[model samples]
Target chain A: MKRFIFLLCLFLPALSWAQLTIQIQKGADKPLSVAIVPLAWNGPSLPEDIASIVGSDLKRSGQFAPLPSGNMLSMPHEASEVVYRDWRALNVDWLVVGKIVPMQNGYTVQYELFDVINQRQVMLDREVGYNDSLRDVAHAISDKVYEKITGIRGIFSLKLLYVSALRDAQGQNTYRLMLSDADGAREQILRTQREPLMTPNWAPDGETIVYVSFETRRPAIYMENLRTRARQQLTNFPGINSSPTFSPDGRKLALVLSKDGNTEIYVMDVATRELTRLTNQIGIDTEPAWTTDGRSILFTSDRGGKPQIYKVSATGGNADRLTFDGTYNARPRAMPDGSGFVYVHRESGDFHIVLQDTKRGVTRPLTQASLDESPSVAPNSAMLIYATLYGGRGILAAVSVDAGSRYLMPSRFGDVREPAWSPFVDRR
Target chain B: MTYKNLGLSLGVVLAMALAGCSSNKAADSANQNGANSGLGSNSSSTFDPSANGNGSNLAQNGRIVYFGYDQATLSSDGQSVLDSNISALKSGSQHIRLEGHADERGTREYNLALGERRANAVLQYLVANGVSKARIETISYGKERPADVGHDESAWSKNRRVEIVLN
Candidate 1:
């Protein structure tokens, strides 16, 4: 009986790993055509098709148009297989081929990238993973191929943290904090509660997450270690406690608190729990985010009578208004490159995610969907995921930073929002 | 106006208020009367927000005040609801908890601040009307806890509110 229960427990998580459906709305005007051939397998039949996963990852970026496997004239696993003429004939700019060989306990995946036009091998690499982790191995190969072809780091291996809520017939909501791969696969529920959960963000190290929860019938900030599943309530102030963002170094957290009579920006040391008040204006100051260098914080404030993005030094000082193009702009998220920031801008009563290039003094809207908010950019700054109302349901959507690609990730269960894209972490 | 006349006017205003919203009318009317009669003469027999309900249920109803979108200021209707409770709030020994909420429209964190501003508005009004500051506690739930889950204006109007919990 114990062994049967153990097996059931081990398999239940796999059975419950529901994936979000991806609907590509738009792609680049001239996406590079690439072909990822089926990786030849020399082992027991694997449950996952590694090549297909890699192909999907690359195609989802909107920078590449993966060729259908049926269109491929020949499948070459190595550079020596030649036959470059076949790929050239297919009008494929890039080609990827690999093979999976089973070892005693794991599998070895060897993949090679080729420039069909140049007829030259671009990259050759191998990765090893256990039976259950073939997906990760495939993602690593995708990352390598994406980087080699585009000269930009890939975000396929990154994870996403978001909140999913389902309202029952009684109108009571059940909220779940969910984690999944950037492609919306390998989903895992981090926490579930009867109360609402909001503003979940990852620490820079990717080992800890901080979020606001109303589990105590009052909003409070909490942090949980991912690897150990250790949970700790970080703040339980008298009033609103929310929008906790980790500093780039992960040693401090910038958040908003109303305990001091009005909502104001504050920073807390992660180690000693010491607090430092940063803003003293009577306006509603909240949604504090750190700059890439950790020297300043960008936040939302209404001191000027409408919500707008503002910036202040990390230690505490006067804030300079950062947005002026819109009457209502709030929830500023600094881009990974520090060249610009992304925020919610109200345009003709519809809220859309807009990217502000600080250096160029130019602003661009990354999403056309109405009611778009809570944008979290990938570590590589190539793409961003945000929550948008689609068909009256709150679903997650992704758009490339340059506004070339767009896709929606609607879950099978309920409303999903507040997508926080994870930083790149070493899986090995 | 006489206490009875005041109760009658408040009741009429509350009925119109309840009629304007698409939520549960019976519940809103009952609560509206309960909020109005808390400070006036305890003769809740004639001014019950509900048609068939008595004074016993008055304390539980009428504790919520609605607001406009992205607004933290108290509406005249909200002020009337509070004005009716002035005596009861000033004399009551129970702690007053003002829980603020916002509709699911804008960003969550900004809504948090907006909710706080709404609750603080109510707190300032109570303090200005002779209620001790020590008797009240305020908290903002932002858009997290929506009284009405619908996405339209009818629901959003109902969700943007402050509930007075006497404990």
Candidate 2:
């Protein structure tokens, strides 16, 4: 089977690290405070800093606040070497001790998670990958540690796609659709267009990504495979062909095209390229996102005279208004658990991310940002990343599902927007 | 002689850093430079010192009609601008491109639809004023193209406009 992991370089290498600076505004009230004891390195050198990766992963989730490496009193390479008393004195909930041994073919990362109160080892597992892929191995270790503690699968290994824009000194605007690690590292540019690029979405199978580009001097949908780097123009109709979203099954793509008339939703088969018109509203029916079950599509329509989140059957029918509390609610992204969805909710002239519980009939704002858009829920539905303005500069930020913790992924150079966190990839 | 064409190239410098892999883009931009040099010189010679902006000033000139926040309908000022363009819009020899835009507010996709609606409103207005529908083509840049880079209303009102480009 072909894995969707990116191991190829078809574009000039993009920058790494330092681009997305993290600022932890808040986190879970009772964050599982832990100490990540610096691991003993047994290699000539290391391509990846495993300890920092794991620590950042845990901290980014807003679940665990790792003790700074400088504060760790003892640097234990193994659980047997760990002084449990030292951690208990620090009042840390857990202690993570690890070691890296260089193998002839690759390297083995052996890590152990210990419960401070119980005074016992909880997780002891080893992952082996080529030294070149140590970053992936580190993320795999983070996933294990996270699941062991929270009982929820971790999404540290998944990828995130976003668009960044910069105005060159030559008086021209430059845009880039970038792919990066969940921690905002190893950014790779997928495509470059002179006009504008918008709304990058992932295919359910995790193989290809769809986005709207004005390369042809008009808004049209395009898809590019992550593995092959092959691109194909999906739609080039007369009018607009924007907001392309892959259906839950990955067999179809529901998008907004203004060919037949005003902006409306249409689904096209992936293989045959056959089109199925979904919404036929003259008023505006755009931003078509499918529910997890694939039976219905949630979109934003202005047919009622105000932009509101509405749901229509996949085949086409009446669109029931799902949001009423706010005067403006657009960009509805369905969570994986079938429990309502998230969208940009505008109130008092400030726009924030809000989660609407479909079954419970309750909606609450999750972000306090005055200007936020393009919210993408992680594969595990535990967190989401969206674009918002920070100090007049556009940046990407993440918020936990319960609105417990938040972090801003601020780009150092230009404005960043339209972030689409990838679906879960490493099922192993 | 009445007005010098301010002659801005409007850079179209939209760069998508799809990375340096675009080895042909250098060549493409070179060719674009060659093709636009004539227009550049023509406008430079007719340069009106009073006109502001050094970049794509097409949208900044009087050809654009501003709109209210979030509303696609035309205001009297906007209508008057289009009213002044009636003679030119009715000229069978001219092809008009109505490029709609929006302020940096709301979701990008929704703003795109709104921009399209705004453009269509302009197209409908022109058609009602005796301009042939076949002579006009419309596209919405959403909030991508801004006349002014500022985030306040002064910048937004100018960004939220429809530009009538004649070719």
Whose TM-score is greatest here? 1
Question: Which candidate wins on lDDT?
Answer: 1
Q: Candidate 2: deviation at residue A23, Å?
A: 1.5
In terms of docking quality, how is candidate 2 classified? Answer: acceptable
Candidate 1 residues lying further than 4 Å off, grouped into runs, are A1-12, A17-19, A426-428, B1-61, B90-92
Per-residue lDDT of model 2, residues A151-241, tens digit only = 8988888888898887543335677888888888878777655568899999987879999888766788889998887899999997788
Candidate 2 ranges beyond 4 A from true positions: A1-11, A14-18, B1-62
Q: Summarize candidate 2's per-residue lDDT along B67-130 as a digit string, tens digits.
A: 9999999999888867865764586455667889999889999999889889999999999999
Worst lDDT 10-window in candidate 2 chain A: A1-10
Clashing pairs in 2: A174-B15, A175-B15, B4-B46, B10-B56
Q: Which pairs clash in the backbone of model 1?
A: B31-B61, B31-B62, B35-B62
